[model samples]
Target: MHELSIVMNIIDIATEQVQQAHARKVDSIELEIGTMAGVEMDALDFSWSAAVRNTVLSDAERVVDRVPAIARCGNCGLEFRVSEPFMPCPACDNVLVEYLQGKELRVKSLVVS
Candidate 1:
C-alpha cells in the first residue's frame, strides 16, 4: 500500500524536526488527515508500527484528526458536507464544486523531548 510511503514520509519529517529541536524522541504527533485524502486509517496504522521501528518516532503517540469533507457548489454557492466524490449539490444539483476542506494531509504538530 502507498500508506507505507506516507508513514515513511511522516517518519522522515518527525525525525528531522526532532533532530532540529535537539530532541531525542518524539512524545506525540498530531496529524490532520482529511476524509477525501484517500488514506485508509487501518492500513496507515499497520504501516506506522513498521515504519517507526527503531526511529525517533518509535514510541511516539499518533493522533489523527479526521476532517470532514466539505464542498461548495459553483452554480448555487451552496456549501455542504460531502460523503462521497462527485456529489451533486443539493440546491442546484450541480456536480461541479470546489472543495473547501477535507483534502488536507499534513502533520499539524509534534511534542518532542
Candidate 2:
C-alpha cells in the first residue's frame, strides 16, 4: 500500500530531524491529517510502526491529529465542514466555495528527549 511508502518517508524525515537536533530518543511524532488527505489512519499507524521497527525511533509513538475539511461558499459566505470532497454548499447550493483547510498532511510537532 502507498501508506507504507508514506510512513517510510515520514520516518526518514523524522530521523533526520532527530539527528539534527541531537536528540537521544524520540518520544512521539505528531501528524496533522486532513479529512481530504485520503490517508487511512489505521493503515498509516500500522505502517509507521513497521517502518520504524529497526530504526532509532523504534520506540517512538505516532499521533495523528485529524482535521476536518472546511470550505466557504462564494455565494453565501457560509463556512461548513464536509466529510467528502466536492460537497455543495448547504446554504446557497453553490459549488464555487473556496477551501480554507483540508487536504493537508504535515508534521505538527515532535516530542524528543
Candidate 3:
C-alpha cells in the first residue's frame, strides 16, 4: 500500500527534525492531513507501528488533525465542503473550482526530548 511510503516519508521528516533539534527521542508529533490527501487511516496505522520501531518516534504520541476539503466554484463563486478532489460545484455543477483547503499533508509540530 502507499501508506507504507507515506509513513516512511513522515518518519524521514521526523528523523530530520529530531536530529536538527539535537534530541534522541520524541514526545509527540502533530500532523495535519487533509481529507482529500488520499491517505487511508487504517493502512497508515498499521504502517506506523512497524515504521517507528527503534526510531526517535518510537514512543512518541501521534496526533492528527483531519482537515475538511473546502472549495470555491469558479463559475458560480460558491464556497462549499468537498469530499473528494474531483468533486464538482454543487451550486452550478461547474468543474472549474478553486480549492481553499483540504489538500494538506504536513507536520504541524513536534515535542522533542
* C-alpha RMSD of candidate 3: 1.2
Candidates in descending lDDT order = 1, 3, 2
List residue ranges in candidate 2 displaced over 4 A.
none
TM-score for each of the candidates: 0.96, 0.88, 0.93
Top-scoring candidate (TM-score):
1
Clashes of each: 0, 0, 0
User: CA RMSD for every model?
Assistant: 0.8, 1.5, 1.2
Candidate 2 TM-score versus the reference: 0.88
The residue-by-residue lDDT of candidate 2 on 1-113, one tens digit each, is 88898888787888888898998767988889898888987888788767888775799887878888999999999999975788999888899988888878898888888
Per-residue CA lDDT of model 3 for 1-113, tens digit only, reads: 99899888888999999899898888999999988888988999999999899988899999999999999999989999997667899978999998898889899999998
- In model 3, the runs with Cα more than 4 Å from the true position are none
Give per-residue lDDT, candidate 3, residue 86: 78
Worst 10 residues of 2 by lDDT: 48-57
